[model samples]
Target: MCRWLAYSGTPIRLDELLYQPRFSLIDQSMHSRYGVETTNGDGVGVGWYPADSPAEPALFRGVGPAWNDANLREIARSTTSPLFLAHIRASTGTAVQQTNCHPFRHESWLWVHNGSIREFAKLRRDLLLAVDPALFPTIEGSTDSEVMFHLALTFGLRDRPVAAVERMAGLIEAVARTHGVPAPLQMTIGTTDGDRVWGFRYSSEGHSRSLYYSTETAALQRLYPDNPQLHRLSEETRLVVSEPLGELPGAWQPVPESSYGVIQKGADELGHFEPAAP
Candidate 1:
């Protein structure tokens, strides 16, 4: 299990979201209130698209707790981005290495997840074989999260993200069933291609992990009418996180179970998500 957040819209310093919030991702790393684990100390990663360079995101990651990383704090303070993804890892049977850290990237695309594939040891080989051979060499981590990213890529994530993810899930469940394992998939995932972000909440048993999106700007403006920062942000600004960054009333809305959302420059879109044939 892990914790992650994806931000889009206004360009803001990483610290404003990763550190300055009352319950920031860094705070969640040690005192997670919703994740399966209380401490996600295995590693941490941040991927951001510089305003001047949107085609590729710069990434910084390390094999240590995010709360204790001085460099992470410094980088957060200095960097600003309109779109970014950050993750804190709590190793789920995977090596605690930099490669296993998330916000994994490929060209302009980035992905992160906060759940695992049940009995992955038995299902790993079959899943790996399903990946496009060309992408197989890019598989650098043992974590199912990374494999799932590649699986979605192989299933055509670059073109049809929602359908690609559905197919990826369907393939995993199909393989697990053949191996006599039930309830094979569980995930709260986020992915982006520097333009739009997609988030999904699903599990084989229906009760997936927590995922929430920020309230619309109009609502936020009314909620914090006098807050200058809220006034400064664009109407399209949005944040999707595994848990609320703070306890601001009416600020976060839970992503419906078995649903996915698309966050972009205008009104967001929400749709029912289901696993389908690969």
Candidate 2:
């Protein structure tokens, strides 16, 4: 599995979370504490929404370990975004290439995932065949994560995200069952459309990968009374990650297994998540 994070709220420099945190994504790239593999150096990618452009988010990706990427560090220090998704890849039987990096994009949406479809080799063809014919040509990589993004798009992610993802999961499981694979899916996914962000945690056998979201800014401020930065961020600021970015007490909350949630301008919403009929 990989490591990833989705930030939504105030427009801030990427390094604020990517490099500055105690256990930042850059640190996770080489020494991840919670991922299946300690080193996720297969590839790395970052996607962020520019303040002036709402139609699509810009992406920067490379087929190198993030910790050693000078360009990544340069970009992280110079760029800022209101919303962004960053990922450090650990191949789950996929090639190490830019196309296989996470934070895959389609129009206004950006997506990243931290897990895989068990025995993808057994069901890859079937799953690809399930994607809408029009959308198939747009799939640029062979990784299950990118394929899963297109599957959600085919299932109507733009207008109905949660349901679209649920349908996508359903299709993966249906194909897996036909292939005799007991557990077909394992994912901790994050997706956004330059505005709101949605995150999901689920797997076929019930125990999914670890995922967490930052505690509300209000709570953090109270917990770290002397930390002025905590009080500067909006109360609506939120971060969903494969693991907590830091060890600050009460600064993160684990996302419950088999659930999904939305992060928007106001109050965030969390609810049960389950595959539905495709």
Q: What is candidate 2's lDDT per residue for 1-278, written digit by digit as tens?
A: 89999998778999999999889999999999998899999999999998888677999999999999999999999998889999999998989988999889998899999899989988999889988999999999889998999999999999999999999999999888888898889999999988899999999999999999999998888888899878778888899999888888888899999999999988899999989866
Model 1 lDDT tens row, 127-182: 99999999999999899999999999999999999999999999999999999999
Predictions in order: lDDT:
0.94, 0.92
Poorest 10 consecutive residues by lDDT, candidate 2: 228-237
Model 1, runs deviating above 4 Å: none
Cα lDDT over the full model 1: 0.94
Backbone clashes, each candidate: 0, 0
Candidate that scores best on lDDT: 1
Tell me which residue pairs clash in candidate 2.
none
